[model samples]
Target: MGLLFILLLGVAIHWASAAKLGVVQTEGGQVKGKNVKVSLLFRSVDVFKGVPFADVPGMWEKPKPHPGWDGVMRADTYRDRCLQVTLLQKKTRGSEDCLYLNIFVPQGRKLSTNLPVMVYLYGGAFLLGASNDMSFLGVSLYDGKEMADRGGVIVVTVNYRVGPLGFLSSGDARLPGNYALWDQHAAISWVRRNIAGFGGNPDNITLFGQSAGAASVSFQMLSPHSKGLFRRAISQGGVALSPWALQKNPMALTKKIAMKVGCWRMNEDVMIKCLKMSDPVKLTMAGKIDVLLILGKGTVMDLIEFSPVIDGDFIPDEPSKLFHNAAEFDFMAGVNSMDGHIFAGVDVPSINSKTANTTVKSVRGLLAGLTKEKGGAAVESAFSVYSSNWGSHPDPAVIKKTVADIETDFLFLVPTQIALQLHANNASGARTFSYLFSMKTRIPGFPSWVQAEHAEELQYLFGKPFSMPLIYFPRHRDLSKYMIAYWTNFARTGDPSIGESSVPAVWPAFTENRRVYLDINHKISKTSVSSDLRSYYVSYWTETYSLLPSTRQTGVLRAGDLSPPRGRPESSARET
Candidate 1:
């Protein structure tokens, strides 16, 4: 009996030794990860969850490298997510000890292996999001394992601070904001130093994200702080050029929170100290943040409150001006068909119930005020360009649809186009590609016209339909495969079509003269290769609005003054 037990213990020790890593260990210690078999690909991948990549700094301070520790930290489970408010701010979950990141490496790799690495950042309007096993209908929305297996690369999903804890700034030396940006920067630095331990090629890293995460990828590309951390970038449905990407008044939320917590003092430094000592849960729900764009007549636009601001150190200047180094990056960006449903549905609520043209009346008044500022011709030209031409007594549903289209054009479509053009021009043939995801995948219960809403393409890219086959249609599986291939290919090589995997259609590069983009819609088909989508409207925004007294340096163009207004979305962007 003793001999049999000794033999079993020796075999267990042998298997453990085989899995042990070399000199590339986390700051805390060595991590013990599990080998998860990806059923769809019939392959297994090594996953290390809750790895402490950095030790986040205090209340409003920047993050630093994690101090080394004594022994193995056991990274098999997800650590606490950064403290955040959820369930309508009625309750809160997560903790300040939440600077952990999850790493996924493809199986059959060794110390000598040199695979490409992709770091993912989640988007919650910079208010709320997590990198820990996000799922709906049994689909892991942001699983890095699926990408690792499909792309044959190493994948990293990082957790950065959000909301007041992450972005509160006084626009001064006392309380500089952008702690979240520092968190992301530190994570990338950690990858550059430590990813080689897992057989990852640190020199060939790709940064990709959706919405605010996509905006962060843009920041990472443009900011001098992230100069040599990454070489490639992809932004989907969002970019730093979007009006909501930068904060107008970084100090407003700080004041509100200080008042609620009874920490309101004359000095900013004193306020920071009080905030650090308060209960984190109370801190989460304390402040009532009134977001951006108060137009003429005190009309507030729909925009997120907690986003990065110009601390003059991290951001340095306006987003548009920072693209001078664009030639160094291989860039890809695009938008969804109805990305603005999140804004319009709230701005024009329950079309049938609010049938008295209540929403329309408010919008018209808002337009009149805006035209008053710019000119009467502004409203005239806007209506001329976007005239639905619906006869009297038009369906309220149609009115809501029009609002959605208007929002989509201003917020998602045009901003993405301007950004694509900027990168393509500056890249000087370094391979920039753009695409529009128009897959007829509308949110359930939303109006039929609201097709391909924002963040819908993410699931397909993350391989949700493949994992939950019974819940989706066959077309979904096909699209998911194509997206995974294209994305991983971009991460591996500078070009999307030059890799081991095969994609359905060859994705073309975007250039100034070509003005090309790939339209990815499997259900309702369009020409695979297209050019300058909606040129007339694009011209309307780029030409007419460029004349307005807007500052790209500040990134503060109100949707109403620049175009048309339909801005509220905190109650709406989350439903879908």
Candidate 2:
């Protein structure tokens, strides 16, 4: 009788444990999700179909509470990515109702303890991306079992509206612009309210992003609305201070896009109606949208025009000015060693000319707010420096590489560094950390010239190294493990140091004098990288180009008293 009783108790315990770790019923339907999953070689966790943070809204903007689900929800498979119209392709399905968030929790024994939360914002130049991309799976970063065995943290990835629908802003009071940013805000609010149910500490949320996502993160730091949304921030490759961050006049641009789709002269109400009436496929096709234009130029327009803007509300001032004021926040910002190489291929001179010219124009425009003389000189100096750096390389490929590297520094890296410096100088208690990802992948069929190319880190960090193009390579597991450890550690402690790893030396912080950085290669190491390049960039920005007025710098030609309120174009050249 005693043996039988013991056996019955053991069976009951096993069933209860399985139920707790598996699927749970909701108002919707049956759902199952891993309590904690291994992603990117780290013991992190993920929970899907948990709960919606906000009430659902109907097509006409009628608010409705989310109808709870029935049975357990299986969160094993990723929800479908948000709808996007790929610039290179068409006929893709994207839905307007695609707002979702995924969570990754670190493995740990005490399941009920609160854990640090890292919220990731993805980047596709603010035009294309979703939280479900294989590169961002994050299972390896927070495998539940492993996190339980060791200590744990929580990871959250969110999807925001992208492209014209999300960013288009009209200066007109009728339009509520920056919907994409609003989506992000909503996601954060959701995290604050409900993350504790999944063992996440709402007070310890860290916001991080790459590329356009990074730019968005920067904007959040500057925005009063996002003042307390996150305690720390990590921006990779994209900084909001850059000329390419937000559109100068988004409302005007949105009108242009609207006209292209036969919605010209329409009021906000009519415009939305027309947009909804048109087929999504047809609407995407009417615009001669190139990937570069969609990604690069889109970010520069006005908040109401077509991009994130200096709205008196959501975004109060330019990111540069905001950073200069030394806005308080913990930050980690850096750029890839070959950030521009992704755009520069075998064509050397042609590509170099295009890139250099565009950069010169942008630099000139940015500095116009200060003084014309200074802005022109700054542009000239920047071009001269870039040319000299590339002139040393005899090989076209090498020359292209050099030019790309210089451009990356001028456009992305320096701006990020400057923001960090400004923040640090203000004595904001927020520490600034920097890193350079230079690890070259040995993946076959992948371009050998494209070492550590844009978006390469996504695969290893997501623990999906064997997925798609990355699977063609050898040593995927090795690389994935290293990436997982670094990212997870950063998510946990706001520092990426891994003491137990075979990897070399601790990554240095970007302090006042000694600007230490981590060079992530085949093996990670600490080094004083890109100092010379950064110095040149700073000189150009401060001395040569600090004279132009903000409106002029952004190419907003203001005519004299009667000149149509704003100035006409000075030249017929393509802006942006």
**TM-score of predicted structure 2:** 0.74
What's the TM-score of each model vs. the native? 0.85, 0.74
* Local accuracy of candidate 1 as per-residue lDDT tens digits, 1-576: 999999788655544434334234654578778776565322567788888888756788888778867776777788787888873766777888889888888764233268899999888888788886466865357877777877788889989988888887888777788889889888888888888878799999999888889988888888887766887999998888886788867777778788898888888788877877887678777643443344334222334777888778888877777777666889999888788767655554553243355356655544443344455556656665555444667566666666666667767777777777778767755778888787865466654556788899988888777777888888888888888888899998988877968877777887777766777865323347666666556666766655665322324232322232222221111112
| Residue 290, candidate 2: alpha-carbon lDDT | 42
lDDT of candidate 2 vs native? Answer: 0.56
Clashing pairs in 1: 302-567
Best by lDDT: 1
Predicted structure 1: lDDT: 0.73
